[model samples]
Target chain A: GAGVSQSPSNKVTEKGKDVELRCDPISGHTALYWYRQSLGQGLEFLIYFQGNSAPDKSGLPSDRFSAERTGGSVSTLTIQRTQQEDSAVYLCASSSRGGVGADTQYFGPGTRLTVL
Target chain B: AQSVTQLDSQVPVFEEAPVELRCNYSSSVSVYLFWYVQYPNQGLQLLLKYLSGSTLVKGINGFEAEFNKSQTSFHLRKPSVHISDTAEYFCAVSAPGNTGFQKLVFGTGTRLLVSP
Candidate 1:
């Protein structure tokens, strides 16, 4: 079976520009998540979408960060007015029937974004 | 809220040598623990998890973690690590809320360097 995958393995942009990172979760995964990995902040959760419930955006650092899962499968994370602090590897993960204590999350290759 | 702490930022070991990566967490309520590994230029993958039933959880790539509730620790250990095992290890915790939403809180990660 195919695992989770992301597009644009690498992206470099200037400050104040906009960048979009995409993620495709495994088939039949009802729960999807976005995370950011950086030298300063480590790994931080960005957003979460489970089934049809409202997406959890609590982990989003700022208002400039937003994400949407279309048709409950693919998710896109958009960072507007990118800053140098936004330079990091954006990771995506998915799990089957999330919220369970033992559910395992499969991760994608990740999209490395560099904001100059 | 749950948080994970990995005190060791880096660990270097020789091939076929035993190694231990310490991890401690703080949480008011019961929590789920997990260990993940990330190779260079790749996404993170699950190493092991401790949800219930047993305190000792085994994972892939010859890795295992022991969850201790009294000490609030879940440390990863391997009897003899190989060169291929060199990677970054992360300890994470999650406490499901009333809505059963699980958001992982990860540590800063420990970079393990294996020398042959």
Candidate 2:
């Protein structure tokens, strides 16, 4: 079976521009998550989506960061007015189900975003 | 809220030597624990997890972790390591979210430098 996958393996953008990162979770995965990995911040959770439930936006760093999962499979993380500080590896993951501690979340090759 | 700490930023070992990466977490409620490995230029991969039952959990690539409730620690250990084991290891914790689903928190990460 195909594992989780992300598009645009690498993206470089001007500081003030906007960028979108996409994620395709494994088949039948009902839960998806977004995280950011940077040298200064390590790994930080950004957002989460569960089937039909309102997305958890608490982890989002700011209003500039937002995400949406359409048709319960593909997810897109959009960053508006990007800053140099936004440079990092954006990772996506999915699980068979949400709210269960025992469920395993599989990850995808992250999209590295560089803001200059 | 939950937080994870990987005190050792780096661990170096000779091939076939035993190694341990320490991890500690803080949370008010019961949480699930996990260890993940990330090879250079690759996505994060699950090494092991501890949700319930036995504290000793085994994972892929001859790695294992012991979940110690009293110490609030889940340390990864391997009896012997190979040069191929060089990578970054992450420790994570998850607890119920506001919506009653699990949300994960991750540690800074420990870089394992295995040399022949």
Which number leads on lDDT? 2
Runs of candidate 1 exceeding 4 Å displacement: B97-99
Clashing pairs in 2: A99-B101, A99-B102
lDDT of 1: 0.90
TM-score of each: 0.96, 0.97
The residue-by-residue lDDT of candidate 2 on A10-30, one tens digit each, is 999999999999999999999
- List residue ranges in candidate 2 displaced over 4 A: none
| Tens digit of per-residue lDDT, candidate 1, span B14-94 | 999999999999999888899999999999999988888889999998898898899999999999999999999999998
lDDT of 1 by residue, A1-116 (tens): 49999989999999999999999999899999899999889998888889645457788899999888888898889999999999999999999978776688899999999999
The residue-by-residue lDDT of candidate 2 on B1-116, one tens digit each, is 88999999999999999999999999998889999999998899999999899999999999999999999999999999999999999999987776676777899999999998
All DockQ scores: 0.69, 0.74
